[model samples]
Target: MTTLTVFYIGLFYIAAIIFFGGLAYRIYEYSRTPAPLNIPTTPAPTTAGGVVVRMAREVVLFESLFKSNKWIWVFGWLFHVGMAVVLLRHFRYFQEPVWFWVEFIQPYGKYASFAMVAGLAGLWARRFMVDRVRYISTPSDHLMLALLLGIALSGMMMTFVAHTDIVALKAFALGLLTFDWHPLPADPVLLAHLTLVAVLMIIFPVSKLLHAPGIFFSPSRNQVDNPRDRRHIAPWAQALERDNA
Candidate 1:
């Protein structure tokens, strides 16, 4: 194996283990930690219809994001759609005899890359140009956006402008999957794109990007807002209490 291959493989394993292990440990610690439940002293929504409307507005319409900043909502939606499309397109790397669906989506992948770059640029621009965003944005936020933009832009260049030998790209990916390391000659542009993607994956679980998973855990979204008189505690929690007693 070439030094480059070895280095990249080592980086991949190290990143995967550390990122996953740390995430697991963090979740374990969070589960063990006791949180004070400040059940709202504020008056609850008087009617079921009102509660349903409010919940629908918050969860479905992203009322919080709209209330905070319309640009945030716009950029956020674009970023997510672009990322999803790009990721799906990457299935070409893994599948031998490139899948028909991948072929079909190739054009969409180009558009997705464009959208991702545009969204990232807009977001970064907002961070600088908007007074509130500038005040609140951290260096990490800027770095993440920059990295994503770099990856998307490089990918776009590879697709539309600077063509790389994608056969070599497939070989390299398959080699990685099969544990048969091959030094496939890839374009520097491709290397930059892959490296940025790797960096994003490594940083993702640790960063605010974790809000992807956090939304499911959100009390407001996941917890049903019914009157305490109407709902009963889960049998599992009651059983656990009985066992403890």
Candidate 2:
């Protein structure tokens, strides 16, 4: 293997460790955190089943975002759905036979980058164009958008502009899974795309990107709004009460 291949193998190993490990720890913390009140947002679900349906809507449809702002919802939904399809399409690289769905989406994923980039551009523009958003926006937000944009643009260049050695690339991806460690193509654009992806993974646990998982644990969104029918006691509070008794 070339030095570049060894370096990337090591880099990806580290990035995977940080990404998965850190995300798991953060999720555990969120689970353990207590909600002091039954404070689901108004018009919230009252039953467990209702909460499930509500969460489904929030996750898949971005219901709250849609209600709050149509433009933001459009951009956010476009980015998320396109990125998801692109990721599903990438499963072709890691699997030997490749699932039928993955094969089917290859053509769609080829063009999904355009939607992804367009969505990112719209979102990035919102930061500058909206006064309240601009006031609260930090450097990290801009940096995250730029990083994603870089990855999408570089990927598009590889697809539409300068084709990389995809056979070699797929070998490298499969190698990572099988511990075989194939040599990676020395294409600069491909390298940049992979590097940006790695960077995004490493930062994801610490960044606002945590919202992807954090939404599930949100008190306002996930709580059942039945305080009147049932006494709301936090797990920690219940323990304390038992000890007192």
Top lDDT: which candidate number? 2
Candidate 1 regions exceeding 4 Å error are 19-63, 97-100, 227-245
Best by TM-score: 2
lDDT of each prediction vs. the true structure?
A: 0.73, 0.93
Q: Estimate the TM-score of every prediction.
A: 0.78, 0.95
User: Clashes in model 1: which pairs?
Assistant: none
lDDT of 2 at 107: 96
